[model samples]
Target: MKTVLKYLPALTLAAGLALSAIPAMAQQPAAKAGAAPAQPKSSPAAIAAAKEILSMKNASAMYANAVPGMVEKTKIALIQQNLNYQKDLNEVAQVVAQQLNGRQNEITEGMAQVYASEFTEQELKDLVAFYKSPLGQKLITAEPKAIGLSMAFMNSWAQNFTETVMGAFRAEMRKRGKEI
Candidate 1:
């Protein structure tokens, strides 16, 4: 559990990215019988377009904006997992922050693969153009704040949901006159 907690931030980011890809993958049309399987890497044109889209979205900057929140959340988890390591908390957080930033290129590369596979080169170009537009830029700027708010809301909802579920479980146990 402690080891899991230590890697929680990376896992969370990875899971979030992976989950976001699901809808994109689902939206793709089914290939005809005997069609070639999807390749692991995209074609050069698609890769170029994906990079442009990423640039237009300022993907790295957005992740950097999100880092503070990630750091704070990780700090809390570390404290919970290692209460006796108060003196090393700051150093640990600094190291985590550095590691997260260092991995941004790898994350962006994975994202580019997802985009390239899910979208044609033309589609990626269109997306890049849209992101370069004012409205798309507005969304890009707003996304980090939206993500933070969404996380907070989900956390609160989960707490309430857990309490509700546990209450129901206790009621059922009492009804059965079961002692624990």
Candidate 2:
């Protein structure tokens, strides 16, 4: 489980980049999690275009901490379950982080492969052209904040609606001569 968790970020980075529908390069070995699901055979031109697209999107930010974060999260989880090892785990965290340094490319490469597989050479080139345009630059700059604000809005809406639903339930229950 620990080993699997260690490599999960690579998979997550790949998936996350795809879901972000914007970004960089990333890939890993099969031992990472499992055999990567087969990707469509992309032409060299397509792959190169995809790589350029990812670079322009600054996809590295999406995965730069993945390896270190994995190490830290694992260390914390271990320390919690083995209280006696807390000190040792904390001491080893830096060593672990160092050892795993540079592995983020694994994620970025896989992400690039995904983009390459999903888009044809022409499409990837078109995307690169778009990203190079002023509007594309604006999107790259603004999308993350937009996503953050959208999430915040959704959370607030859910919280308020949850309270409204609870109030409605309570009112219905009261008419039935019960208090909740």
Candidate 3:
């Protein structure tokens, strides 16, 4: 009986550790099953048409332009701490610009594949024609402003939704004798 009592605490600790590990173990099969195979490369002609459409749309420039603002926002705390932040930020921006430029081809190629797969060759040609027209050109120019407005609206909506949902969650947790 004395020996059994001595080992009982160790057995309980081992059981607690095993129970803590169950969530991690449960995730392994889902990860293996959910991975998809790599897609084959797009054809050269399709790649060319996609490139033309992407250039007309100026997609890469839009993506690259967004990075600097995002990076600056992320570094706000560091900027507050240092007086030489302008110089540091400029250098970091250059490096980030270089990296974006370096990856531009890969990004463009991926986008081209999406275009190629989704649209027929004739459709892509028609799109190129449209983009070359005055209306399409206007759309290209106006898109950034439209996107900015859309994002602002969505952000306001998300904040309100998150607050409402979290308030309910806290209430439920409190009812269960747990506060989060």
Q: How many backbone clashes does every candidate have?
A: 0, 10, 0
Candidate 3: where are CA atoms >4 Å away? 1-44, 62-103, 169-180
* Cα lDDT tens digits for candidate 1, 65-170: 4665678787988889989986699788888787776655666787788778877778778877887899877866675455555666777899999999988998
Q: How would the candidate models be sorted by TM-score, starting from the highest? A: 2, 1, 3
Number of the top lDDT candidate: 2
lDDT per prediction? 0.71, 0.74, 0.64
lDDT of 3 by residue, 55-94 (tens): 7665565455445555666566566777577678767766
RMSD of each: 8.4, 8.3, 19.4
lDDT winner, 1 or 3: 1
- For residue 25, model 1's alpha carbon misses the true position, in angstroms, by 2.4
Name the top TM-score candidate.
2
Candidate 3 to truth, TM: 0.48
Ten contiguous residues with the weakest lDDT in model 1 = 1-10
Residue 74 lDDT in candidate 1? 79
lDDT of 3: 0.64
Worst window of 10 by summed lDDT in candidate 2: 22-31
RMSD of 2: 8.3
